[model samples]
Target chain A: MNPMQRVMTAMGQAEPDRVPLFILATMHGARDLGLSIKDYYSRAEHVVEGQLRLREKYRSDCLNPAFYAAVEVEAFGGETIFIEDGPPNAGAPVLRQDADIDRVKVPRLEDCPGLQRGLEAIRQLKAQVGDDIPILGSVISPFSLPIMQMGFEHYLDFLYGQPERFDRLMAVNQAFCVTWANAQLEAGATAIGYADPLASTTLLPRAFYLKTGHRVALDTLPRIRGSVAIHLGSGRGLSLADDFAATGTVAVGVSAQEDLGHWKLAAGKRFALLGNLNGVEMRRWSAEDAEREVKRAIAKAGQGGGFILADNHGEIPWQVPDEVLLAIRDAVERWGHYPLDWKE
Target chain B: MLRGGADVDELSSDLRCALESLERSQVEKVLEAAIRIHSPLEVIEGLIMPALEAVGEDWTAGKVALSQVYMSGRICEDLVGRLLPAVAQERGSFPRCAIAVLCDYHLLGKRIVLSVLRASGFNVLDYGRMEAPALVARVLADQVDILLISVLMLPAALKVREVRAGLDALGSRTRIAVGGAPFLFDPELWREVGADAMGRSAADGEAIVRRWAGEGAP
Candidate 1:
């Protein structure tokens, strides 16, 4: 089967030719293309070129057209700071004070250069790959975008203190998320990677999120077209497995803190499981370590399909050596076959 | 002011529970009662600090959410400012300490660490967000004795080495403590980055500061 067929089969909880590899390489694409991060992410063609080159080199299944997470903030009229070594960061938060909330208006996709590049990349990649490969697009969830908008501490204060304003902000962000995700889908993305780190139980009480962030997600995900994979950066969210599955997402991205087998068991067959590998540690991993991790992950969660091998955090760090990616690729190719027989 | 002769441990436990539940009024009430009977420092060190530490411990264990711990720290910071008397002698007794977010904009960890240090009666300089060279220059200019750096990303975490080398080039004796997601994920990363110590939480940061201050070693 082709890579897209393999991923679709897994998403359907059926055994594919092999477990599909979704190496969540975003900024690393720029690194691989020998372009400065700013230059590489400046145009959709650069991103598409980087993605194609990365897939050809690594032999990964999915193509991620995402530039960086902070680019989502730019759509809200926020500025971004591009760095030499890593992903661009959101500049000074857009909402420093409560008054700034009124100034926030959902931007036209064409006006936002950062998001326009991403959408164009998706369009370009789709035209090229043509469903032979899955193109994953990403968006910052409304509940978590405030971390870049008003800052984490201030956002929490706003969340706990001013309920009405919090609702107002969520409404704005929710609209943006739906609009952005739908635009990516319309641009021919196979799925949307919904990043909502703040909604993770690590950041907020599950009960609190159920009433607040969960509602936003529930209200937003259905409006977007195509598959949605909910990823909570580095949050430990084994307990939130069911909660995430209930959010109308096709899969949930688990963190390094969760065991792959446990997450699979908790999630059951309700949705797919996309990750659990520690990307940070992967930076320092030897080839043997990479192989061992692959075998272990496949052995644990690759039982009845519904598992796409990837890192805990959605993006691979630019600092990770090329050897690590190669090792992971080779390991997955070797050990990621279906109906695997391995001991615990 | 000790209502019904409340035990320190019991009061601290109650405070921790209140903090975990995010009951701001209950936290204030507990602090007020404790402060009436004990000296301000005693109330902070014996009651408020311990309660915050418990919340931090719970957070580390994943038993409580970070929002609770963050809110608890913010609440205590406000109460500490309002309730604690200005003990001039105790205020500047520790080393000249400052906390900065090195090359990253995320300030949650730094804010919590700052609050914990202040509640523990340490005068800490808040440097806000700074890059490596600017941070090094400011530390040198301030003659900072101890520097605490927080970063959310790995690249920013690695910048700690640059800050360390900068300080060494200047022949400065400012000891550095690193904290953040990167260090917490990778043990021995602090030492690898030439930091004197690493803290997993705000409570751990305060303890490191106290230990380093007591040793009087740079």
Candidate 2:
């Protein structure tokens, strides 16, 4: 089967030709294309070229150029610092105080420069790669969206000090998520990656997560235009895996920090499981070690038909030697075939 | 009458409560009450730092969220800023520059580090998360004794090599000391990123800067 077919099959909870690959890729492409990071991320043409080049080089099953979560943050009153060879950082939040949350107006999603660039890139990527390669667009979930409101510090203060205001702020964030997801889908992204780093268990108590995180995913996932895979962070994501799987998402991005054994039991055939690699360590790993890790991940999570191998965390580190990425793919291809041995 | 000495038990409780609640006023009031008896340095090292550790523990234990961590860390940042002028002179002195590194905006780690550095008597140049090129310009211009590069992302830690090159191009002798989540996880990463050394913690970073200040840059 082809790349898209493999991913779709796995997402469908059925076996594919092999284990599908998924990763959050960016800067690696710019380095390959000899393009400035400025143009690579901001300019649609370069962005498309960058993703295409990476897809070709990595031979991954999906194309998701999640450069940074600040795209929509910039749209909603935050500034973004776009460096030449690095992902952009979210700017100082325009909404600093709890009072400011009241006056906050969601910006026109279509007009947001960051989102527009991504849409154009997605369109170009879709046009060139066609349906054979599934192009995914990423968006920050609403639960964590308020972090961009007045910065993380103030948002936390609101979580405790200003309950009513906090509820309103979340409402506004959910609205923007819905609007942005629809826009990306309309623009050509075949699926959405509901990137919610804030909802992870590392940050919140489960009580808070259920009300805010579970609610946001519940409200937003169903509202998405198509199958949306959720990429969460921290071990808390593991605890919430069952919750996420129950959200009707296509998949849950599992981390190496989490036990893939538990995920096999928790998610089961409900949705596909992607990732489980320690991305930072993979970069610094010896080629031999990197392959060992890849083999280990596939052995544990690549069982049955529900696993798409990838790093459990955010984007691939820009500076990780290209050898590491190649080593991972090579190891998976050699050892990731299904309906065979998983005992080792 | 202003308090003349810190009540170890009373001040500890006050500091703990203020931090647990993240009440700026309570923290200030308790800190102010304690400062009359104890040097702000003593208050930070003895009271505030311990409270920060508790909140940090709570965060790591999953009892708190990023907001709590950020707020609690910010409270400490604010504490140092408020207390530094009074107590900074007592600590040994050094000149340094620090940045949160490019592409990562998580600054609580750097903020706490900056505060601890200031408390350690370093006249730090706060170059808030600028792009590497701009940051390189400031570092070269300032000619600091120690360069504290605080990076949370692996890519940002790797970008330190470029900053190291820029400093080298000028034939400058500035020691680069990297800290933050990434380097803390891998002490050897300091060398990987061309940094002269790695700091295990805020207190450890202070020692790294002091040594670099006296010995000059690598």
Top TM-score prediction, candidate number: 1
Q: On a 0 to 100 scale, what is the lDDT of residue A27 in model 1?
A: 82
Q: Provide TM-scores for the models.
A: 0.97, 0.80
**Which residue pairs clash within candidate 1?**
none
What are the per-residue Cα lDDT tens digits for candidate 2 across B66-178?
45555666666676676656655665454555545554676656766675555433467787776667777887777676777777777677888888888888887877888
Ten-residue stretch with the least lDDT total in model 1 chain B = B1-10
lDDT of 2: 0.73
Stretches > 4 Å off in candidate 1: B1-6
Q: Best candidate per lDDT, number? A: 1
In angstroms, give how far residue B122 of model 2 lies from its true place.
Answer: 8.0
For candidate 1, give fnat to 2 decimals: 0.73
